[model samples]
Target chain A: MKARQQKRREGRDSENALIFGDSVRKCKTLGVAKRAQEEMVGFMLVILLVAIIFLIFLGLASMRSKSNVRESAEVSQFLDALMELTTDCRITSFSGSVNPYKTVEELIRDYDRDLTCENGEKARDVLTRTIQEAIETSWVFSPESLYQGYTFEVDQTTGSGASSTQERIVELTWQGNAFSCTHAIGDTKSVFSASSTIKARLILCLSRSE
Target chain B: MAFVLVFTMIFFGIVAVIYTSVSLSNLREQVAELRERQALERARQLTGVPEFAFTPISCSSCIDFDKALALKQVRTYQDFWNIKFLRLEVVYPTPIDKDKECSLSVLPPNCGYVDIIPSPSGNIKTKTAFVDLVFWDKNKGAYVKVLGRVHISAFDVER
Candidate 1:
């Protein structure tokens, strides 16, 4: 009886050791899989970060290019030339055999003074007609044209500092179609009078045709 | 570990290539823009040249039509400017005669345009700028100013 009891106890001890060894192997396999999953997640995160950075860079580059396209030297030069153009509107008050005609620049200065031309036309009326004709002749705004639309504005500001008052002397606008413009190239020229400042601004809007 | 290292190297190599290409393209655009600006500056400077500039008045952007008419007579200016083409047109008062070219003999009121340098036979691009065309009007007995358009083709030598 004593021998049989010792045999049974040894058998139970062997069985327990075998079970523990199998469980340890299973645990090792699970740990390796878990580590692989963590590594994969880390790699994916790094790729995401790099992709985000690249996208941001591309966005910034496009924005910079767009802004560069908006500032055109041609438009600025045109404005300068427009200001110096001598119009047929001769100011009778300053009429001489030499230079009775007032330039677009001078007309802007005299607009506020309500001066009349030698032909008895108002300075403002002559200015508006001159600007309209010049712009129409220079830039043909049609659907097929590169310039889809344009805006020419003249503003007069009187007084100084806080007492300044701004008035719109002339505003002319033309559009080719209903489509919104994608970009605008614009420039402003300021002509100072004795008592006021006259500002002339020209903006050319561009649209891409389908 | 070796697999991860290889993948990372490949990824970084692609990123570097993309970055380099983008930077190179941007640089090319900037160079093109600079070239255009230089050409425009050259055109603006041409207006202030003594041969064409209006000297009597304090006008900086004025081109004397009288001087330009005389310039048309001097054939030496063609090669002196070294430009492909140079033309000026009066835009205001509707240029009484559109076909007539202004010269020392065919003065303003009779002529509409001046061909300082005639157009070369080829597909060439031109840059245009606005200027004040001023001249002493013999009829009006005073200096007359009109809208002028200056069209200049690219220079022969890169400038």
Candidate 2:
């Protein structure tokens, strides 16, 4: 009987030791999985931070490139000078000792009045010819040149405030290259008449070299 | 652990240095652009001076041909402008004699340009802009406005 009791006690001690060993192995496995998950989260965070920084750099670079192109002062001054140029069209009203010649600005104003020049040419036709000649002489648009194309437009607005009606007097476009224009610079000048306002706009399209 | 900390610190230091260098280069470019814009503004201001502008027509962009020719004779204006070179040229109406220079006796149809201040000897680059040139036309018996160009060059002073 004493031997049997001792046998039973030893069996219970061995069983408890085996159960503790199994639990220790399970805990070790769980700890290793938790550590691997933490490492993956840290790596993802690092990658996200790098991506954001790259985007910011790209944005700054694009903005810098955009700022390099701006409105040209030369174009604006050219328009101002072009408007004051005198044409050969002389108004019949101003005759005698001092025959007054109409300037480009004046011709635009007299266009609506259907005025006739001393040479019997219509004011509209004279004005168009003069402007065409001036533009052709001034700008040389070619693929090799800085400018690829150009557009000159004139608009006349009649009446004041909200009742004003805007009409296009003339639009001239010249393209000298098959290459696509990368940029454009332009300016506008306004001439006030007795009953209307005339606005002249000149836009030059630039090639890649510009 | 100590080694990792040192490596991280060194990496960040390199990044910071690169960022600073890039920023400094961009600032230098901006400074150069500003200088160019300032020079252009100074050139434009030349037209606004009373000595060059056409006062009778009250046109801001018009330069009186008579005034420009007369200004060439005055020696005092040379020191006042402090520029290396100045010139006014009629580009349109296709002057009959392109090479002929304008004087009091020889006018527009006979001459193409007037040298208000002749070019000084140097490698200085010229800046030019379009302007309206108004002159009295004896044949037409009225004032005529022609397309003109103004050329200017500044003296090279070390900044």
Q: Give the candidate number with the greatest TM-score.
A: 1
**RMSD in Å for all candidates:** 3.9, 5.2
lDDT of 2 by residue, A104-142 (tens): 887787778787888999888888888877766667877
Clashing pairs in 1: A98-B142
Q: Write the per-residue lDDT of candidate 2 for residues B51-133, one digit (tens) a residue.
A: 98887766767888988899999988887878878888877776789789998777776789998988777766777777888
Candidate 2 wrong stretches, greater than 4 Å: A1-69, A92-99, A158-165, A176-180, A193-197, B1-37, B156-159
The alpha-carbon deviation from the true structure for residue B41 of candidate 1, after best TM-score superposition, in angstroms, is: 2.1
TM-score of chain A of each: 0.75, 0.68
lDDT of 1 by residue, B23-120 (tens): 89879867876776677777777778889888877776788888887888788888887788888887766677978988776666577889888988
Clashing pairs in 2: none
Candidate 1 lDDT by residue in tens digits, A1-210: 989999999999999999999999999999999989888887888788878987898898788766423566667777787777777777656642246777888888777678888888888888889888887777778878778888888888888899999999899888742223576777778886888888888878776521
* lDDT score of residue B90 within candidate 1: 78
Q: Please report the candidate that would top lDDT against the real structure.
A: 1
Task: Tell me the lDDT of model 1 at A78.
Answer: 74
**Model 2, residue A97: what's the lDDT?**
19
